[model samples]
Target: MYKSLILLLLNTIFINVLWSNDYILNINDDMTAIKVTICSKRPLQLTSSLDNATHYLSKTSSHVEILNGHQLRLTKPDSCHWLIIPTNTESTAMTGQLLKVPTGLLLWRNEQIENDVINVQSPKAANAKLVNHSLPLPKINHDQYKWPKEPSFMSLFAYFGDFSQKTLRISEQSGSNLSLQINWLSKTLDSQYDSLISWINQVARSFVATSVLSGEQTVQLNLFASHSSESVPFAMVYRGEGTSIDAQINPQASLSQLKTDWTLYHEFAHLALPFIDRNDAWLSEGLASYLQYPLMQKASVLDEREAIEELWHGIRRGQTNYQELSKPNLTLAQLSSNMMEFRSFKQVYWRGAIFWFQVDLKLRANGDSLVRLLNRFNRCCRDLNSIWQGESLSAVLDQQIDYPFIQQLVTQYNNSTQFPQTDRLFNSIGISIANDNQIKVLDRPKLNRFFANFKAH
Candidate 1:
């Protein structure tokens, strides 16, 4: 009896001593009962809860209790979490780490817990944005773990807002090297989503030949209105033919059901852009815009005449807005230097697309075609590690298409002080730019550009 009592007393003392250490460890799964001893270096009001428990805030209390089996349990203590995640938790659900506070939270997990902080971006304390890191609270932890480094705004959107999107099985495709899945949560005319998916998959098949990525890789598609520090996360808000903003889709778009097709096609093309030096924003964006018309034609979404007509209108509209487009006088160089500017960057889509349209005309005159040129460009872009730029692209185009025409077009666009006369340019090909108040087929010499191209091919 004396020996048993002595042993029990030793165990009790060990537990108390362990609890007094600087950190408390937790590794809980779907069936776990996690316990955390909350501490705050600064006076803090902690607001937190488990999956099924009611949220509780402790402005005066010293501790909070959380039951297990919850989805996400966060402790926004006055300061960042300072506790060390014990070594045992490394192979459990808690291995993947996320500090549930602002980016300024300079804390780490495990042995890295001593003042070694991964870089992060913090929003104003007034506004609580989604934390940029992936909430890697996976139930099954692995042996080899790669903690996420600091995320860009684009990546932050991918990590946080994805949880909020409702599931819509947009489309899926697999290639030997890569796989892609597309889905949009909106419930309205899902047909637009379907069309976008079809167009993207066609581009992927033609460019990446990814029809075999059954299980190795997967990509998810989502959309949102106000994403945190993200670019291209917002859908096109079309307001008539000349206006669109990434921040808000024009409430007035769908002026006619027919116009929605090109808008969708334009956004979907962004998905296929190659991993190039972002400095080549003009090229990738311009190429994508230029390619959209042809891809739509190939997919039967647009005919030859419709494609050229669209380009003419885009150019005219951008030209009229020329004063505004150049107001900032930010060159493609400044725009590509950072993504923040890329979000607000103006007219690359419009001006660059027109440049390509002119090049297409010139190439056809020289017995070459846009379709063949794009096939070559796509091949160069497909190499994952290769970086592409205007110089490299010009070299490739020189071999397959009209290089002088491309050069002149690029120069005119890069240096243009005003928007081109889009309607007058279209007049050269026999088409008219439509007004926002009216849609009509012009009865001029627009010997259907589409039909001529199909015939020539």
Candidate 2:
């Protein structure tokens, strides 16, 4: 009987310990306030991502105190709760009704929390818009909840108040799948909904067909109507516990205009590899620029000739920018590292693309291609959490295919002061530049066959 009693006591203690890391987040009726309950068995130290977190707090348990900027000390963690009333609920555009909850209030402990579960309770009404967050918030056991890998700042970003949601499930030829959740924050885009969805599907399909995405991935797309006149004003990809994209579109843009826009294509193309470090911005931007046209061509938004012409024009722009911005005694690596200070974006991006184009030509000459290499790399070495430097990325690619060209180019171009010469490379691939600087594709059998095979894949 004593043994049985001890066993029952131990089991109770174990359950408490396991549930201690769980959290309950109750979003108030108006969606302007959030109540956070920390289910802890003992005292804990908490950290906040937002420096002005105290300003948002309406009520807190007596045990909780602001120890410092972005730091919260919990003297008695048991049954502790805090009510946060956020005030930074401004929309990105003036005409948009979207009010984002300043829910960047990410809380963490001194010890890392694993398999953190957050139970979210929100008022359910037909007109009440569902919260759009970067992390997955699915209905689990009759409650809206999320299972985050760990508690971090990225997990805390969410927008509430006004939005329409749609989901697209895409399956590629290679069996890779993507569940894309799109949140339309701008009511002006309602008329272009179908067109926007179609365009997004096409771009996603093209990426998957090229083996840029492997396994199953979920992405959250937040669409906001921009004040700019451009078709797609801007777009950015955020990575943390998961991947999300924030895109701004013009309300007046047509479906055809949206499809032809390169902004979304370029943003999605960024998923081709692991996130490159900011210092190696050239490499990351270069891959996107180089792949954008081809991806557009593959999606039937642009034909082969148009893609080639775009590439040629882009290369010329890069070359021109390099010539104008080149500083004496400054290497490409130095320029790339300080590109923002020098305003050498075009040169950095174009030079990176030129390097890739040259590498592709060399690979094709050896009866291999960049696509094939990337397909292999995606199958083996794609890690969401990994941040790759230019040299490290090249080394990994070389390991996959036993090819030394990628690393060799990295070493050569990093120290070189001049922009990469692509005249020979283009000519070998059966491309030429006319006197007027227009791109002309010659009758090159191998090149034609390669592209034909490329399209088919």
Residue-level error in angstroms, candidate 2, position 347: 1.5
**How accurate locally, in lDDT, is each candidate?**
0.39, 0.70
Q: TM-scores of all models?
A: 0.46, 0.83
Q: What is the lDDT of residue 321 in candidate 1?
A: 51
What does the lDDT come to for candidate 1?
0.39
- Where in model 1 is the C-alpha error above 4 Å? 1-179, 183-219, 224-233, 236-261, 271-273, 276-280, 293-307, 324-346, 384-387, 399-412, 418-428, 432-457
**Tens-digit lDDT track for model 2 on 346-421?**
8888888888777777777777777777767777776633567888889888986655778888888888888777
What ranges in model 2 sit over 4 Å off? 1-21, 40-59, 62-85, 88-97, 101-104, 107-116, 124-156, 326-328, 450-457
Query: What TM-score would you give candidate 2 relative to the actual structure?
Result: 0.83
Candidate 1 lDDT over 393-427, as tens digits, reads 65555655534556545555655544444454455
Error at 319, model 1, angstroms: 1.0
